[model samples]
Target: MKKLKQIVNEVKDRIAEQTPPAQLTDLLWQLICYPPKMPLRLQQEQFLNQAETFSVTVHDEYFTKKDLQINGFKWGNGKRRVLITHGWGSKAADFTELIAALQENPNLEIITFDAPANGSSDGELSNFLLFVEAAKAIIQKTGAPHVVIGHSFGAMANVVALNDLHITPSLLVSLTPFILLKENFIKSMTTVGVPADAQEAFLQDFERKYSIPASYFNMPDLYKFDDKLNHWLAYDEHDMMLPYSYLKEFLEAHPTIRSRNYDNVGHERIIKSAQVINNVVEEVNKAIAN
Candidate 1:
């Protein structure tokens, strides 16, 4: 894998040298938007097979606002709805343990979906804006949930979608959220040996395509909640995908957002932690009770 990455970087360098600036940026944009298809693991397969499945048709702004069908799962038929969203490259079944734990509550109707290009959804490419649209569609279909829980990139999308839709749930839980979209994209491009000039050009092209600056996606500027909303943020200190410093900086700026940090759960493992699942269930139980 290491050797492969080195070869890929070398090829990227050669492309930068050979291709015109516009073509290079366009290629990079395409590469970044398309997520690799991951095979369903045993656990994910088992969870999906056991759950009730449904499909939602949503218009994706990333694809010129074209309509696409997204797959979703439901675990309960309770009055209080709780929506769960998975991270990038992750399917709804990835929340197997968490959803199983949450299902113990008969009063809660737990729901989740696969974003476009992920899981059983129909697409070859996806972006954060598409995720926001999917969330909105599911929320509209199921009615506003009492609690919305999001993991990693899904967490960021939930924040933006809830704010944009003006649907303030009683509780919002963000687990290991990826907060810096623009900064992280640049860092990823740099790691892949994309030239700094080409990176800048790609950002400009992205802005033109999206009709908004990528900086607008950053959590600090995008996060908004009403007084009635209760927000909970949980993250791991040793998250390898997202540095703790980013969460720290975000918390420091917005001191009032409720947050907690764990020691060894890391990024992905945090989702399967018994402690994390229990806390999330407890929060949801509390919300519905009130």
Candidate 2:
């Protein structure tokens, strides 16, 4: 983490000192796309280490189209399937609590994979496109997931993937998801000290690489909740990483979507809540029962 901070500081200093606007913009674009390499946290490490003791089928695959090697783990033999993933810079083990809750259920078959540049996946950089492609690859391999749950960037990307892939998972759960890429880009720019004049250039370079216009990187455009699908959104009002306020208008407009609010837990911690685990289990059981 210290090294990551130093790298970010050095990038900011370079961005501040660069002579040409184009050069500064290019530097900022690289910073925005690069995820700082971080070792697993203590809990993440313990969870993963413990998971290895179980009878889990693990495989490493080089996704030919994406040019990256991805790792996947499959557990249980039930016919019902659930595909789960974590957010940017987060490993699949972030779902430890939920995984534990559902692991005992003999009726479930759980699938999890680390996205490129996250967890054990092999990549130096990743973006929304990479995330969507990873999800599509997993869905293709596992068949349509009856339930799909994702956190933060993972949640947002799943929305886009499910839509683009024409998949209608019976139950969809999104936790602390950003509504659009523009907000995410703005946050990155502010955090990295991209000068006002260089913002447009940075965005242009990004769009050129990703082929996604800023105007189209939005929640509404990426996902539309079908009436047949059960949609759930869990958010923490105090979440500093992703403000729950982003969903205010969207939630009001979508009356059918079930939402749960937590008071003390912040963005990442919400996943560890016992209440959250219970609620998700109950919801999945209901979906399964019906």
Candidate 3:
């Protein structure tokens, strides 16, 4: 935490040093698009070290059309497949517990990959579209899985990917998702002390680069692409990363969507919860059975 503060201070200093408006916008844009390379915590490191003991197969360089190579993992040989996607700055190994729990089902195949610029994947930068494309590539390669699971940003990415690819899974589990990308980006910029003018400039540049309107990054609008889609949404009221109001508004609008509100578990820890894992496995089992 101290190191992160130091880095943030350094960035703020650099921003303060820039005299030109264009330079400041460019710098902020670069910082926003690039995922920070965070060192693995002790538990994450230990998980990776003993990953082989979990009896999963590793694909060192799974190819995508954009020539990006993603590190992929597979468990079980069953015909019923499940794909799990991790959030930004998180790797597939982070899902070790969930993967292990799912392994209890002998008739299931689980697939997960490290998105480009994350984990063992090869890249220095990534964006929302890149995440969507990576998920599409994996689904295209493995075929549509029975159940699709995503956490945070990955949850939003999977929704976009499934709609674009015209591949619908039997079940989709979205864990603590950000409903609006533009809002999230602006919030991050404000947290890092980016000026409001610079934030606006970054948003304009982002839309120009992606060739999509900032409003199009909304999850509820994307969900409209397939209204019949079965969604299992899980969120915590006190998640520090995402305000509960955003989700509460979404649920109020779409009361038919299945959801579970957890207490106490914040953003990241929600994925690691044993209860959440069990619920996920049960949902997957039920989805596959049908």
Q: Number of the top candidate by lDDT?
A: 1
lDDT tens per residue, model 3, 108-222: 9888888877877777667777788788878877788888999999999998898888878889999999788888888887998877877787788767866886778887787
Pick by TM-score: 1 or 2, better one: 1
Candidate 3 stretches greater than 4 Å from native: 1-7, 39-66, 225-227
Regions more than 4 Å wrong, model 2: 41-66
Please name the candidate that would achieve the greatest TM-score relative to the true structure. Answer: 1
Candidate 1 structure lDDT: 0.84
- TM-score between candidate 3 and the true structure: 0.87
lDDT of 2 by residue, 126-186 (tens): 6777788888887887789999998888888899889988888889988877676777787
What local lDDT does model 3 show for residue 139?
81
By TM-score, how accurate is candidate 1? 0.91
Candidate rank order under TM-score = 1, 2, 3
By TM-score, the better pick of 2 and 3 is 2
CA lDDT for candidate 2? 0.76
Better of 2 and 3 by lDDT: 3
Candidate 1 lDDT tens digits, 1-290: 34334445654866657766566775676556766556789878987888888888978767546789999889889999999999987888888889999889999899999999887898867899899989999988888988999999999999999998988898899999998998878877777777777788899999998899888888887888744568888999888877889889988877767888888898988898999989988888898999
Return the TM-score for each candidate structure: 0.91, 0.88, 0.87
Clashing pairs in 2: none
- Model 1: CA > 4 A from native: 1-20
